[model samples]
Each structure stands twice: as structure tokens, then as C-alpha cells.
Target: MTMPAFVKPRQVIGHHLVLRDATPADAEFIVALRTDESKSRFISKTSSDVSQQVAWLEKYAQDNSQVYFIMEDREHNPVGTVRLYDQQGDSFCWGSWVIREGSPSGYAVESALMVYQFALSLGFTRAHFDVRKGNESVWKFHERFGAVRTEETELDYFYSLSREAIDKSLAKYAKFLPGGIQVIAA
Candidate 1:
């Protein structure tokens, strides 16, 4: 199937959450999440300086190749962040997923479903991503979502989920997102 070029949406609404484009004002929240001692271990190290994060976000805003999102609760209170990038043909890589310590139980699953659903609507038929070797919970979550482990390096485990797998997940998790996702173009 021919896919149109990817266009970032202004907002993606899930059953219980909202994912909106990250702005420079979100630098502090993003920094805090990235710098969290427990969470930072698996991801790349980022500077603690908010201004540096702002600058990075500024650059990110100008780059249309990726969509960085701030995940929020239905009330619009920010709870986490995720990003979709590294498009290669019909597949895209997604990571930078992090939920706040006290978020409700299903945010991770819902946010992930939103990502897949939104991407599918944009014509991406497959998803590719990597998890740190030590991030057991996350990798296991992907496995449960039908992502097959495709490659393994000393430091990371790469995985992929085809359109079929993603479709299965959307069905299996229908209750968590009963109405499906709705993306409003930016």
C-alpha cells in the first residue's frame, strides 16, 4: 500500500488520555522525567538544565521527521511523554516512553495503543523499536503486544510488530480504548 508522507498531529485523544505535541514550555517536565534516577538508567543521559532541553525542543519543533508528545490525562494534566521517529519505509521507531511515578495503571498501555493507532492511520503498517537490555517490564510489555524480538545487541533488544500484530493488539485491548483513537491534524 502506498503511504502518504507522515504529518504530525496537533493532538491524539485516547479513551482516557491525550497526547499533544511537546512544546518548549514542556522542557522542565521532560527533563525531570529523563533525569529520574530509576528511569534514566535505560535511556540516554540528558542534561538537567531546562534551557538545554528547551533548545532541543526548539530544534525538534522545526524538524518534521518526528512527533514528540506529552501524554496527558483526560483533564489535560500532563502525565508522561513518548516519541515516534526513525521512519524507514512502512515502519517507524518509537521510544522515549515514560510515565510519571503516580500515573494511573493503564496509561502505558493506552499511550502505546494510541501511538500504534495514530501511526496506522498515517499509513505506517509496522512498528520498530529497541529496549534497553535491563528494561524487562518494557520489553515484556512489547512482547505482550505482539512485537517480536528481531535482534539483540549487547546493550539492547530490537523488536518489530507488523500491521497484523498491531491490529491484534488493538482488538485485544479494545476495552482500554473502546472508542479507538482520534487524531486532530495540526
Candidate 2:
């Protein structure tokens, strides 16, 4: 089976931000982003050690099923992180998403559309993700895309989106991501 290219985007650019694959050079920043108390509550992993962070990056480097991204504003300042991983046939997962406090309101929304576009561009038919049950903000964000909650873990709510739903959501949000979606830029 063919893996999706969003796993390692050279650079998925949109109106408000750029999403690129994570590298060892980003270890410190990734650590800080993932550990911030505000962001850590909803995340499953909270280890703050940089060496361990780099080790995780190294392992991800070899995993075709995962793609970790560093999100930056057009001015090139790191603002967030997200990942698309856990491919099972034509479906995959997207999450590990976090944005800094006080970012422009639309960055998260547009960045998510970029992720869905990248996944659909790879011909994948479904996208799955989990949100901690109490993370109302993130949960609502996913809901806007017409995601349906398919399961509930003790600590999280699992949501899935059909390709058709994603495509439709993209249209609803296209104005926010001007230039459409060039998900894979060679």
C-alpha cells in the first residue's frame, strides 16, 4: 500500500502558516511546545527531556506511518506542532496538534484544513483522531469538519472523518486558506 506524503511534508504552506517535517534541529522547540502546561493537558506524552525528544524524532524518521510537523507563521517563527500517523490501509490519524497561546484565531482552523487537504491529496479515504474529553476547544475544532465520534476511550473521544466530509469542509473553509491547497510542493 502507498503511504501518504503528509507524513513528511517538505513544506505545506497556507495563508497564515507553514507546516514542515520535524527535524533534530527542532528538538528543543518541540520539547517546549509539547511541555507547556497549557498544551500538555490534552496530550498523551508529556516528557520534557530534549535528548528523549530527539530520540523520538529519530525513531519517527524511520517510521513511514508517522509524520510530525513544525508549524510556523509566514515570518518563520515557530508557533505550533502537529502530526499525522498510524496508517491502517487507506485511513490514518491526525493529531499531536498544539498552538501557542494568543496565536491568531484562524491559524488552528486553517492549519487543520491544510492537514485534511494533505491527507486527501494522498488519496486516503478517512482521517481519524482523538481528543481528550475535556478539551472542549479542540473537540469543537474537529467537529466543525463534520467528524463523527466513533469511539470513546476512558480519557478521550475518537473521531473519524470520511474523505467526502473532509472535502466538503475544505470548501467551507477555502476562503481562509486562499490559493486552495498545494498539499505537496515539490
**TM-scores for candidates 1 onward, in order:** 0.97, 0.92
- lDDT string for model 2 (19-91, tens) is 8888888999988888888789878876778999889888888877787889999899999998888887788
Colliding residue pairs in candidate 1: none
For model 1, residues 1-186, the per-residue Cα lDDT tens digits are 586356778999999999999999999999999898877888888999999999999999999899999999988888999999999999999999999888889898999999999988888999999999899999999999999999999999999999999999999998889999899999
Which RMSD does model 2 reach against the true structure?
A: 1.9
> For each candidate, how many residue pairs have backbone atoms clashing (under 3 Å)?
0, 0
Tell me the spans in candidate 1 whose CA falls farther than 4 Å from its real position: none
What's the true lDDT of residue 122 in model 2?
79
Off by over 4 Å in 2: 1-7, 183-186
Cα error, residue 58 of model 1, in Å, equals 0.6
lDDT of 2 at 148: 96
